[model samples]
Target: MAAVAPARRRKRRSVPIGRMLLLGFFLVFVLWPLYWMFNTSIKPSDDYLTVPPVWFPTEPTLVHYKAALFAYRGLDGLINSLIISLSATVLSALLGTLMAYSLARYNTGGQHLSFWVLSQRFLPPIGIVLPVFLIYRGVGLYDTHIGLIIAYTVFT
Candidate 1:
């Protein structure tokens, strides 16, 4: 009984405080870029690129949001982003569910297929930019919203 008690306690010790703290730190680190982007959008560009970098804008303004939403084709970019994100979400969900069902019923690892799909995600935007630029240029879609949508769809 004593030996069994120690084994159970030992299993519970697998996740220690250090691991928890490290995980919390990693989450904060990973999310910091997103937080910074939102923060920048709320702040004036001058304050955004300041020395020491402000953690929180003292005078948070909606000027950037207004500019992005209502000024100079920014709204068009937002709409394009929404369309791309929604399309990718729908496609990925449908494909993932179908693939998962097939794998579950067939008892296949399907790991290589999943790995290849995941590898597509690892590709940086820069990797395909030149090819896309050339293609869009050839097609006379240099600055068109449809071109941007097609480019995003292809990458996804």
Candidate 2:
């Protein structure tokens, strides 16, 4: 036996003026700040603050980046943040994988657990920060990189 397919009508293609205008407006709106930030960032110190405002950086330099990590003593803080972030990311990936497997294959915790996890996301971080801060301090986890990593893992 053979089957016949039904005939289909082609879609009419036309760009609406309103949508095009909206797209153009959003493009400029989003990109203008990014363009201005880069334009200002590359300017030399002398040109960074000029009488007439040198918009194009006559003598561009990478000093701003150097100053951020060196002059402001941010290198240690940056390294600590990186360690915490990476640890949290790795732990989250492992736990998330196991949780997903259990939920999909074994239906662990049932729908109630899933609902509870989903609901936790709706609660603002500010609500829990105070209690968490006190508990972490008492347990000697406060101000340590491990504390930060554990906190990051829990948030997600």
Candidate 3:
């Protein structure tokens, strides 16, 4: 008599328990800090610096956000920050794109250019901050949005 053939087993489509645990831990690590920041931002001034701190606000409030956006002290600073940040971002993208095109198309050897760009990142910001501050003072552009844009462009 012929023997019957056994059926083939399909592979299981599941992650290993170890991987799942690692992923869960990583997600909690990343998200918990952000959640804490938002939580603190929404908490009342009285509860902000308490011992152990509150994970979730007992009486959630929008006062901090409202003050940040609409109040006299907050709104002015926010506007100034937004203007400077947006200006810098736009300028950097434009300049970097042009620089990238030049670097890509030109047959300048890779190592030197790479070193040049990498070197910029190593220079301590504190070392140059004072000279920049002095220049801005001389130009009468200190504390101004345009001055900030110029400074950021030069540094980046």
In order, what lDDT does every prediction score?
0.77, 0.87, 0.87
Model 1's alpha-carbon lDDT is: 0.77
Q: Which residue pairs does candidate 2 place in steric collision? A: none
Off by over 4 Å in 2: 1-26, 107-111
Q: Who is ahead in TM-score, 2 or 3?
A: 2
Stretches off by above 4 angstroms in model 1 are 1-14, 80-156
Query: By TM-score, how accurate is candidate 2?
Result: 0.71
Per-prediction TM-score, please? 0.44, 0.71, 0.61
By the lDDT metric, which is better: model 1 or model 2? 2
Q: Model 3 — TM-score against the truth?
A: 0.61
The candidate maximizing TM-score is 2
Order the candidates by TM-score, highest first: 2, 3, 1
